[model samples]
Target: MTSSSKISRRSLLKAGGSIGLLAAATQIKTSWAMGGRSRVGVNSPEQLLALSAVDLSQAIRTGEVSCVEVMKSYLSQIDNFNPTYNAVVSLRDREELLNEAAVADADLKSGHYRGWMHGFPHAVKDLATTKGLKTSMGSPILKDWVPKHDAIFVERLRQSGAIIIGKTNTPEFGLGSQTYNNVFGITRNAYNPDLCAGGSSGGAAVAVATGMLPVADGSDMMGSLRNPAGYNNIIGFRPSQGLIPFGPTKEVFYQQLGYEGPMGRTVQDTSMLLSTMAGYDSRVPLSQKSSPSRFAGSLETKTQGLKVAWLGDFNGYLAMEPGVIDLCEKALKHFETLGGVVEAIDMQYPMDEVWQTWLTLRHFLIAGGANGLYAKESNRVLMKPEAIWEIEGGLGLSAMDVYKASKARTSWYHALDKLFDTYDVVALPSAQVFPFAAETHWPKEINGRSMDTYHRWMEVVTPGTLSGCPVVNVPAGFDHQGRPMGIQLIGRNKEDFKVLQIAHAYEQASQLTRTKPNLKKA
Candidate 1:
């Protein structure tokens, strides 16, 4: 059977009318190009935003745009729309942005352009430490804390000529999918004021969606990048874990579930940032030395004959939103038409076991690292329930518990290997539901099934995170209510380039990227 047909039939049987649930709103009107340069794989307002990163880069290279002008455009967008969305927090020193812009403009006059990123403005997830900048990681405990040096990735960004405009918001300590913090408040969706933007890169998603920034950097531990990208109708990429390095961290939190990557309006833009961010680091032992290739180059790879596996549900715990599965199925069909082969695959892993295994390791690691904060009285007040839960989870985990979980990782890894051996790529809903209520976390109950944990509803991202595979969250389309949804392409570990190539091809073929969300004014 044709892959698309198989998917359609399965989704119709499993999700039924779930796909009919409509999004509450659409994205606001905005310019798709930065300097009259159109982007590839873009069709709608949603796709137009995805073009932001690449368009800005092109404009800077061609001297058709000034870094100052681009920054101002995004700054103005943030000022005009952020109060409604609360996506950006702790903006860079405005004077600093101006000064940086002036420097870039001078380089243009001197004929000393700085490669592809001379004057672009970008932001990172608040969790990434920035030198001399306040990075609260969404907790009141460290609200006044500022680091003395930039995270390795942030420094690389500056060297690449991306003006760091500000830090995006996240849930406390980057734990939940909803973006909110005690210090900076909540970040709402750009498409609908009352809907969520998705987390822990939720703010990054909103910033790109509303044109506040052309491209933003974010981290994913359990689908932060993928979920928000889908939630906000943008592109979020989580590269192979070691592709982007984290350094100068004494704690191994970087090794657990965390991976720093980029989010943008288009796949090309996402690729550009990834290329700039990737490379080797002596400090990060896990880092791989790679001859950096511009991610944009891989977009040229053809998708014909690419093998893909569609795991619409892994053992049935991943429930689909009625239309979400349908839209994603259509997107998969586009892949087939592009000469790719897709097939259904059954994975051998219990949903609860995988989640529990994840929680056990994640909590154990984060809790141990956060011990110092727990000892501090002031920091304790700012500690979130999730943080406390993790701490407690860590405390309760015996050495045997950890060892057992560690042993389980082997089985999970083997299962992933077996699956990858059969397919070049795996497709799944990026998030089971369309953007949920912006005011609260994902529903604890969906269609009467109890979602026992904050992470339970987001099981779709687990496979990628656990396997350390490169996963790209491609915008699918909006449901009836206009809320955005997306599908994920999970490639084998170290196959980051291949994943991007497939997504780039599918993006070009589907024409779904052309759809933009209408920004709702509160």
Candidate 2:
């Protein structure tokens, strides 16, 4: 992956089969095809790209490495690999970013340190707004919409001295977990370029996994953050609901289904970014008031006598691919080595009831945001079928229907509460199936079972989502074909740090991300 041997859109087209590659082809060629200082004779710069976010931050802050060199290294990585992976889009010019890095270097010379992320090169998930950056949200209609204001997290990133380089690709308006759209074609898996990079944080995951970006900010509605990290063999942590203030948007009160989180190649990096992104904001009425600094602290924790309950496919309710469970189970065995107790537990609550509750809430929230698009006759045509379905389902719901679903959701929470009392943490597969073909929209069926809706294949994630609990997607080793999977380590409500601590211990024992992917062009 050098600028001299840069990949063409035709090669990318071959890597990611036709779905919506034309727009992506044009965008990639236009944005990153401009040559940068290639990795040729740039071993030290290449090494800079591989540094953990924490390490990079220290280097920049102490002037051990100039910010210009750090930014240049990342720009080179993006120039070389982004075309083939399609992980980054709307990238800024290399000269402009290098200049900003120079300013950061000057600030350090003046002893004007900003924060832990001083001069860190970063990219926000396309779904989030960054002032002046093109935030397409994976929709061509909004491709030119430059936000005048930053999302709260984006502001935090900037305040911490991160230079926003660009936006990562996501599904159209982030409606699904597979990353592809009319806006950006598809974000391919880091290990296998032909496979799908799970979404809606697909681009963010790939960026972190491949060193296109050090760490990233992504929001999860379904398995948006967790699934992509699992697919890319990185760490994505979805904190407890309201742990990070999200959306200065219209329906902040009612919409509790989604959360904004951090993704990185390591738990320490992810948690450090979470520290920057978390903390209370009055704009979000439901925002957590607790300080987020604890997450940035040492993740080392003793796992002796830890109790973990493995909820594998809810006793056969989830239609897993043949080896998905086995791989996650093997990953879970690492806990036993740390003197943790692992037990497989059958779900006591009705899983279907949880599904129904999730359907109602998801429809209500997704439709709430997308209804305006659906209302306009012209724009309605631009929306995907799943978006239309969510809009229609939300429009048709009566107050009684919403009330009944809320009650069911409460019952489901009680069931999880009971489990948490017995087991310190609950574990499940992050995704029911492995990464599929990049060209496919979504999995219509799994293991001879028909998926009734677009997101039903991700049923394994609902319990954690609905419970407003913290969940960490810890990488499970790859399968025979080299497809990655992950295990979800879940904690009780508002116990975000506890979950991070456990995941940190397991991460240290497994040392999974240390095994870098063997990247190849399709």
Candidate 3:
């Protein structure tokens, strides 16, 4: 049936039918693309999926392809792969998505184009609220709760004409790097379903990696975006703190650590999504007043004569899995070929103190938000054990502990700022270890060194998080096992555009983003 005719039938069914009829309507054999053309399995879904968001947006704008065709391609891929990967949860009804795509196509025909993301199918991280969609946050306690309004970032995506497909999986309240939670189980790596997809942005990374979505949105407090991007072999950019504000909160003037950003298969696609997400708003007190045009324009910036600092394992203080550092170092060499001056620099901050400060403040934040949930006798049982431990740990923290951590964080920022004076960007491995077993919650040790806490193994990303710098995870290469690895490019605070420029240069030279996962057996 034609796309519009199918939508019309579905609309009639919805108007006078039971939930069963709506469910059945989703299974109708609607045309997979516009003009009654069938692109599914005939035209390559892989090729369509491989197109950058910029290229895809242009295609939609120029009438080369309809938004319906694009949406159908992604929905087909998700149906074929999401069951095994478990990357996307809380999916909307299929008929409803196609109906929206039909509307987007109609709007385009009438010259009512929205923007770059017009008609693109995208998913928000489960942590963010999407009005009328389940905002589970990967917690069973909220399994059925739908938000009344979209989060700021989600609202921006909608305004830009991106269709909200579903919520990507995340850990409960996004507390850990690993993406598993009691609600949706585990979100496995796109490279290998047996291994974990690093999280709490794991699902977002996997969705992009597996062609389930062209690009996705995620947040980072402690490398939630970067770690998953590293594991999945994609680009995850954590913009500088306040570049994209954290909001819909009670305390507006608080010290912000977490920031929302974009994830995609390539740096250019990520920049496109970032442009839509970032802007100044009085509602988000920490939001920076900057033009989104800076991000898109910065992609054309050259890397020649740029000073690139290579920070290997934080000067050997961070424990890395075997071959992780070597892989990252090899990726760093590519910058030199692009005319970047690569320097081996030591960021000589007390590593132990940095970790202590990060933990103290992280736990403090966790406790402040979660302690109330834990206080409810009936709700306590719904919380995860690690979450409970973190909340209780925060309860025991003294005011002096928070103060000391804040002081340490300030000192670390000064050290980072001093290094930036001599370097354009600092590069390191995005994750300390490659993808591990999906069953494991967190790595207990790295290279025989014991990890005191569940999150200690992920200390490589904490420095960037603590410093509030713009960090981008670009595909580095693969290890012996062929699991993906990535290099983190840390830019000076609020120099988000420069960071994207550097990452884009390295991405173009390396071309590692072109590599696709082998999901045949998966």
Candidate 4:
């Protein structure tokens, strides 16, 4: 998967998929090279579950591993771990998935490879609809309602060779960071089954961290991707706005902040998934025109003399749990070691103004998107409090208020834009605190600072969200409790590849990413 487009579509037929076969063979020949390289595990069931998506794809394409073997390994992993972590839900029956895997294997033998994913097993975040699979959105209201059409991203995943096995859990309406709902229950942390997995991409992150999925697809609109990756010790990349076209929804033009992205154990793997997930869609007019295959290119970038701004706690403006800052600061030392200059920078824009702007847009979108539920008294009764709060806030807003909020968002983007003038990337701790207990919803307080709202504790993520830039959550070291943390690297708006490159370099330099969680079972 390192170089997917290496075999051009036209040449794919002429060469009889020889380019992929050669590359796949080479990749299979090399086993699990660390420092941002894909992990190519042995073909046995346990080791097959351990292979990175890229490595697994190569092995499958090259006939080193069968799709049925891969499927059984992952299904076994899910059966073993998912019951306790609940990372995967609405799983299709094992016999059905195995039959599908057999079909994929048959296609492979016929030299009818679908795409880069070529027979890979995958589970989408519960928010995205998969033709026959339940989307639930972590709400009981939609628990049984299966969509006839797939989300734009899901369509691409299917177009590639990914087998849609089931859905990963999420928060109700994806309102809060915590991953729990009456429908699916909690998605526990991959490291500790009792702690928060960090949602709405919580289950996606946990599945990837625990090797239940080779690489997973997730979306980020307020750290749904980043925070969970931080919590689970995996990679979550939120590509720049319009990089991945979002939907075929009713309101396409105004859906600004959130976008689909990828989660994986390695930057290389995430890049491979991103290629399949991105590209222009007519339904999403704002979608970027450039070919997404560019993202799947080599991730080795020269960080020589790169400049990174450490926006730690926003110069004491944002609250942090003890040692969070120190952990990130130590992580930044990797950048320094790579000949990159690191500087502690203060918040360029007013934190309060940014917070207010985020509130306005988030509320406006939630209310408008989920008005179907919020408007009906019956469905409203089933809605979570956070969803209700956001909807109510949005309902109370005037047209002028939304206009002002957009203006404020523009102003914040401009402020961060100036920092990019001197620095290649702006770094921030992915979250203010370590992963907390799954029983706890949102953190009520960080250290001694009281949160004003359910989402206030996760304020560290909003700047990156509001910037509409490319942000990648790389592994920051863990706490004394052995809880994982992530440091986000925010790159220029369209510099998605650059961010991945720098993150790759940092990942290679830092020893943290090499340590996988000692999995705990309930």
Candidate 5:
């Protein structure tokens, strides 16, 4: 096979398209694939967007790149295209950010350079408190809630020299999978502007996908990170719970399931961000110290002979889109080609029971938090009906219900533990389906099976969240509709490096880490 035949994942969209434009810039449309329609922009520049944080970091550190230039490039993209996708919520600190970058450049010139993230532009989900910036949790209740001090993770990023540009959008209180809220509106997919960017980290994924930033930090509870990453054709890593701390909350709300994680265009960048984001925090009692991991440094190593268990549909609770499954299956073949052992395994856990337990706990925590808001009339008016429903559900739950659900969670983890004994990793489709319409929540009927709650359709992610396993999402390949799909690479407990190793190997072997979403104007 010729070098050209070995397609890089970055250019897969152009090469695999019907027109087959290898280097023909004109034939390749620059618009993002949206809702099964490709919007071809007139006079669209041939220059593609999408960059990894690692490369951006190296350029800035070696004086080969200017932080101002980096920030300008992304800021311009956001300015030009963000209105269509609604990916960025609020960006009032442009003057402040540019000033910070100029200072960083002066420092770097004087040999006072900070490592990796120095001067690189990045955004965090609005749920995180950024000092002096409006940190709206997509609810009007906190529309004017500006924190006086930065969250610890935000502080860590700043210490490493990361430029705080703006905050991304999310659902009301980040309670839903969709990114739309009353405050900042909705975030559309980068592939197609009309479809939903899977939330509540949708805006973060879209920002990274559309080249507004090298990477973004987001919190995931349900399928937030994984779904948005898949929808936007990027990598979203939901680290082992407690790896990235969530600061003190009004209540423990979804404490077991909620996690703050990193999203980027490639596996290495995601790993690098995870390293910076992971550490024990006094602020979050649940936070655990990772035993000094080197996720970024180990990306180039060979990962042959890693044991991976490929679970097709999580025992069929969720339906898989045709092309989504086909692309992931083909990507799995690449794993075997890289000398990794792939085996089809039967997960003995009950899907219905797990879904029920997750719902019980999730509703209790979320609604319980909403209870505080319900007491305030103004806050209660801004709360979404779904949020209200959840709180009502939580109120209806008896002490026995909570106890039974907790017990079931323990039992489920033990069952999952037995499978990890035979396999080092478990692979599955990141989302049950591709990016649907911006108006819909999760897909209701998939392959003719009716799903109950908005969260019930994407049950594959529950096991990973419940088990607190390190899950790495890799852009598997695009579906026939031009929408992207991803494969979830799950590793053993605290075996984050192992998952990163395998993802890096597949990323290198397939050479698909560089695929950039064509964000043509609608």
Candidate 6:
């Protein structure tokens, strides 16, 4: 392969014309079109638009392609579909991104490769700060707030040579499981525009699924990464707490439940992104030290003797949408065929108690984080109902309630430790339901059970959050409505790489990651 950098502008325009002609001639929806149609011809720009980040990076490194060409391809796709999907919000000027890519191409030719992600276009979740780009946390209050400095992880992404394109959308302060905010409206699923794209990483997942981006960065607290990945048929890995440094915050020793990690179309791509995102920083007191290479280097481990505990619906105690359990069960059976042993496991701890404990700690964090905004009466009206509810819930907790919640959390960790002693991994559904309608803020009920709180419908993912364990959400299969679903592999605490190993093995055996959403009508 050779770089196409020298191609004349006229030739590039002619090539673009040919792509349009091919789409009309075959009546096959090109990658730029929506409504689930197949992508364009092989080796075409349309195909390049769909390459994984790993492959795209290698192409730039080896001079097989110029960074400029790659950026143009992705930007074109984003232009065509973003209006419908509402995935890539707070977008930067295109000329600026293309200019940066041109410089990257020039540097590569001069034998100055910055890193693996050199020249790749990326956007951080809106919850994180980005210098000179709108950093709205999906709240109306921060609609015009562009930070002068980047968030720690965002800085790391820049140091690794990723060209920052913009910021993706999230829920109001990332308060809900669905990605809709007063600032930018709802982010629709890439697979089906009329359906919801699970949040608060919904924008990140949709970007990856729709070829708007090859990979993205997301944060998870109560399954933000996993739920969106499950709904969009991609990979969302929430590394163990402190594995990826989180804050330059006022309260350093707080409950520490949320984590930032990578989202991608494949496990390898996700791991490759994690390599850059994970490292120690003194500013974040809880940061852990790990060699970046360990993430991608350890992907080849075999699963021949692995023991996986399948906790589908936490042993059938949790409510699930129709066909969710069956789809996940069929996906788990692939592990048995890969020489791994699968067994049914039941939780010893009461799930309702665990759910309540999670709510207490989670709301505590929310209230603490929202202290500044809540101090001003004028800002209260701008807050979402869910945010207000969480703040009040946290404020209303008594000292004894917090102490009991802490005790329950400790017990939950102990139970997980005992389970890991006998099993290599515990598997479960990433989300309780498949993608819902785009207009609905949250599921009012599931399986005839009313969801009392806004986040109650997402109980299946709370255990991993409470235990502070690493969970990887991989593609399971699709529901009858043709929407995607996913299963999560939860590993022991701080054993982030081990969890990825099992997920990679399952990904290799099932090959479900090869599936892409059909988006021809958007």
Residue pairs with colliding backbones in model 3 are 177-199
User: What do the candidate models score in CA lDDT, each in turn?
Assistant: 0.77, 0.83, 0.83, 0.85, 0.76, 0.83
Q: Compared with the true structure, what per-residue lDDT tens digits does model 5 show for residues 1-522?
A: 001122234422232222121111122223323333332322222232333466567656666567777777778888888888888877867788788889999999999978689998778789889999889899888899888888778888888888888899999888767899888787898877878898889999998878777789998888788888877777888888777777756444346778888898778788888888888877687788764358657576565676777776754545766566557766777776787676666665577898889889888787666687787777667777788888888888998998899999988878777767777788888888778899876678777787777676677788888877888888776665677778888887777777877777787777555555556664
Better TM-score candidate (3, 5): 3
Number of the predicted model whose lDDT against the real structure is largest:
4
lDDT of 3 by residue, 310-358 (tens): 7777657989998787677766767777987766666556788988888
Task: State every prediction's TM-score relative to the real structure.
Answer: 0.90, 0.91, 0.90, 0.92, 0.88, 0.91
Error of 5 at 359 (Å): 0.8
Error of 2 at 111 (Å): 0.6
TM-score of predicted structure 5 = 0.88
Give the root-mean-square deviation of each candidate in angstroms.
4.6, 10.3, 12.9, 9.9, 8.0, 11.1
Query: Model 4, stretches more than 4 Å misplaced?
Result: 1-43
Candidate 3, superposed: residue stretches over 4 Å from native: 1-44
Report the candidate with higher lDDT, 3 versus 5: 3
For 82-193, candidate 6 gives per-residue lDDT tens digits of: 8899889888898999999999999888999898889988988999988898888998888999888887888888888899998898999988899999889999987788
lDDT by residue for model 4 over 59-103, one digit each (tens)? 787777888988989988888888889999999988999999999
Worst 10 residues of 5 by lDDT: 17-26
How big is the RMSD of model 6? 11.1
Off by over 4 Å in 2: 1-43
On TM-score, the stronger of 4 and 5 is 4
Measure candidate 2: CA RMSD: 10.3
lDDT (Cα) of model 3: 0.83
